[model samples]
Target: MSARETFTDRWMTAMSHAHRLLLKASRGQLGATLGPMKVVELHTIGRRSGKMRSAMLSAPIVEDGRYILIASKGGDDRDPFWFSNLVANPDVELTVGGVTLLMRARVADAEEKAALWPRVTAAYGGYSRYQEKTARDIPVVICEPR
Candidate 1:
């Protein structure tokens, strides 16, 4: 298989299995296998239709009691569509560590971004590579509990 195909296979196998486990149980055995990494659910409003939508995400850690999510889109050239949704509506609902909270998201200021970006990205290694793959700066949103 080609290198790209191999990468695609690995991604498919891991995500599909994880997704299945999530549907079956709120906290699955894989959570234990993956250390502090946990699946997060984000609820956002559609930018065009204003309809509500939810997506499952993998996060590394929570810092200072705040939730952080990167708009990586798995290193795609385009920012995730959800990113635009957040841009249109900063308020979001998120489930983290099995708890749900309403949060207001604001794109981090550059100074704050400089300090927090490294810490957040280091917590999840793939984030750095994702940033490298895209020309645009991947946004890191700080979601404060509301």
Candidate 2:
């Protein structure tokens, strides 16, 4: 059973739907870039409903054919729905710059997160502020091309 939506959840859902619509209308071109960061469309199977769900996320670091995503959720205490879905099913699809590819997602361990945290903060300083806003340990997810 789905939980009742709080005001924050409702707001987030509305914004996500709008972004998704824009992303789809442009064939993943327009909304693919957010300021200095590049955005990618992550497609995953819903953990409960078993349906495809897409989220636009910033890929602050891409190295060695791996795309790194931060599960900051704007620093919310709870993990994002997409993060949960990714954890349940690592295999997913990603559309970057209009090209879709199969990928495997995994949460970075504490050591790995520590190593990449600097790079992540450097890429976007706003993340640092987000970290300060919440007590939960934000996750760093690595998506490698399959």
Candidate 3:
């Protein structure tokens, strides 16, 4: 990884840790929402280690009981680790607003992405900027109740 990418990864790791701590410290009262997005704790089985892993992510779009997540990784060229994990094992657990539910995750197909991209960028323009920073097409993930 380039120096900038390495730094970004480290920063993201730290922020996720802090976010989880905040949620735990507040007993799910705080860190549940961020700006216009809802924060969710996504748990997936590690692809290589065969262990459970989790990440704190924001749901940019929630429609028809489905949560849409962006696998931007701050616009990194490589896919995020969490994204790979979910691809290997779609069965996941999502915790939102102190409610935990079993969910299945899948990458949105091209047609779905085309329709949702505008809404996602509108919800957070930063996502547009993130897309511009990388050559790879960032994936849009959908998590639905299982």
The 10 consecutive residues of candidate 2 with the worst lDDT sum are: 1-10
Per-residue lDDT tens digits for candidate 2, residues 13-132, read 777778778988987767777776778889999999999998878899987889999988887777889999999999999888778889999999999999999999999998888899
TM value for model 3: 0.94
TM-score of predicted model 1? 0.77
In candidate 3 the C-alpha lDDT for residue 115 amounts to 97
> Which candidate gets the maximum TM-score versus the true structure?
3
Ranking by TM-score: 3, 2, 1
lDDT value, residue 44 of candidate 1: 88
Runs in model 2 lying further than 4 Å from the true structure: 1-5, 26-29
Candidate 2 CA-lDDT value: 0.87
lDDT (tens digit, per residue) of candidate 1 on 1-146: 67875675467447745674765585554443234565667788989999986666665557676777777777766666667898899899986555678998778788877888777677777889988887888888788887
Stretches of candidate 3 exceeding 4 Å from the true structure: 1-3
Order of all candidates by lDDT, from best down to worst?
3, 2, 1
